[model samples]
Target: MPNPKITTLIITYNEMDYIQKCIDSIDFTDEIIVVDSYSTDGTYEYLLHHPKVKVIQNPFENFTSQKSFALKQAKNDWVLFLDADEVVPEKLKLEIKSTIENTDCAAFWFYRKFMFQNKPLNYSGWQTDKNYRLFRKSKAKFSDKKIVHETLVVDGKSGILNEKLIHYCYKNYEDYKSKMLKYGRLKAKEDFYKENYFNYLVYILKPAWKFFNHYILRLGILDGKKGLIICYLNALGVLERYKELKRLEKKNELAYHLVMP
Candidate 1:
């Protein structure tokens, strides 16, 4: 078999439960490069022991920089950038191998099957969720300084893969809330850096709008309880984003006052 070697790159932080499963699914790759953010949950040690994995311990600054760094570390031009919480399906593996050889595209987008707390949400604004995960290292690059959804830029042509990647996104209630709050804070920092602060009115209206947009407009009602939970949590994440944004605003104000003598 003429193998077009692929370097699978992953950026992780404390993803102990899912990391091993994520790696085990991608056994077809040429080499696995795991960029871990000093995980204390035994994830780093496990990857270090794995024979096929080339584990690198790097401080996670943000998603964009970490992913960009991972891209540069790829030995092969064909790179499959995957999250530690996501698993490549069996069919996707075969599809990827075939497409990399047959297709002339610079990069490819893969749609995901979103799972939340052991349940699948068919709607809740997740119907068409997709990302450019498979791409040529030389052709694709990530947008700078985005804390979440660090957009990937493809230079040439792009296409979508047939099979969907399974994303075990939210494990439980507490876990989901913690993640949303953390993402909201990170996004707030990015916004603060870019001088994109919002007003006091946004604190209430934005969160309300997010819930309605997801649950009502996006047809989240169809997914039942799972959909309701997902939609509520997603809206909560948005609320946290604006709350953290205000926190940052107050923080800088205090610092400015203290420094002025």
Candidate 2:
């Protein structure tokens, strides 16, 4: 039987460090469609010469929208969505090729193994990570509500894949902090726009709960220093997000009063 053709879709921003490796990992695929956000870090320039890769620039508004646009650009029935910081290992590649040729379901979910600070983490909420990234083009659509965490809604039956998708999540504290700040602000804006009420008590208690949940309840302590840092930083991110949300609310309120009352 002939190998089934698949279009790999990727949404990227300033991802120069991981873009090349991410594209190279799926070299066996038929076509790669990348929707970049006018990367100032030379990510777009580096991918310009690749023959099999088609790249386009769109101002990134949110994850769901950017991904939806990329999905439309896909030229094949079977499509795979990958992040610039992720790679499909050889084993997973073989499985993907074989599965696509004989897929019984419309979509497949694969477990993701995350690498943080150059170390692969086995616990602390990373072990349970899974996402539906491979699907029939017509069967998948990202949820309409764009937020910090957007999920894909599959129209038909979904199956699980045996192999794991390797994710290079963060190389160090600086990488983690950059994403933390960016995502924090985005999430705060989403929450504010959604009219989610903010409670002072909840704000004070939430981060503490998050730290405990990750560090102790989730066995983050077992992973050593990296785990502790990860858990703590995540907690900090939650706190910072709420703080940003509060700031936005205050600024809007002041503007309204100054203009009218």
Candidate 3:
């Protein structure tokens, strides 16, 4: 049988627990490129021993820069980007192998099955979460956004894949909160730099509205306690982002006055 003509690219930062499983699932790929962020954990050591993996140590920049760097490193014309915390299911792996062999589409989006604390989230505004993961190397690249969430800038046609990729988001509230704080700070800094000021209404009302939309309108309440937790966290994330933006603006204003005066 002929080997699948695609490369798998994964960007990592201390993702030791999930890296091996993610790698094992994509055994069909012709090449595997792992661009790491100088992980102090055993992730680097394990990748070094893996015969199939090409490991490159790049210091932490942002998502877009790191992913764009990884895209350039891929040997195959076709590429699949996988997060270290996400696992490609067996059926999805087979589907990817077959789809790439047959289809001419430049990219394929797959449904991500989100799991929170070992339970699959059937509701809670997470279902039908599709992301473009498979694409032609030359046709797409990561946007130059220095932030937590970076979108793919694709020039070619894109389609959807049938199967799903499992995403293990957060084990508990603490994990969610930690990410919220970090991402909020980064997002706030980005907004502040762009001169996007935070309004009183936006800061307060937006979070409340988001909670209502996610938990009530989206039927997140049907999922029980987990749903409520997800909604609360989502709202908290919004609030933190606004608060961080205000703090950043204040700091910048103080620095400017000090330097000028």
Best by TM-score: 1
lDDT of 2: 0.87
Candidate 1, residues 52-93: lDDT per residue as tens digits? 899998998888889988888999999999999999989999
Tens-digit lDDT track for model 2 on 237-256?
88888898899899888999
**If both were scored by lDDT, which would come out higher, candidate 1 or candidate 2?**
1
C-alpha RMSD between model 1 and the true structure: 1.4
lDDT of 3 at 21: 82
Q: Could you give candidate 3's per-residue lDDT for residues 99-141 as a string of tens digits?
A: 8877768898989988888787887788767888999988887
Badly placed stretches (over 4 Å) of model 3 are: 1-4
Cα RMSD of all models vs. native, in order, equals 1.4, 1.5, 1.8
Ranking by lDDT: 1, 2, 3
lDDT of each: 0.89, 0.87, 0.86
Q: Could you tell me the lDDT of residue 72 within candidate 3? A: 90
| Candidate 1 vs 2: which has more TM-score | 1
Kindly provide the TM-score of model 1 when superposed on the true structure, using C-alpha atoms: 0.95
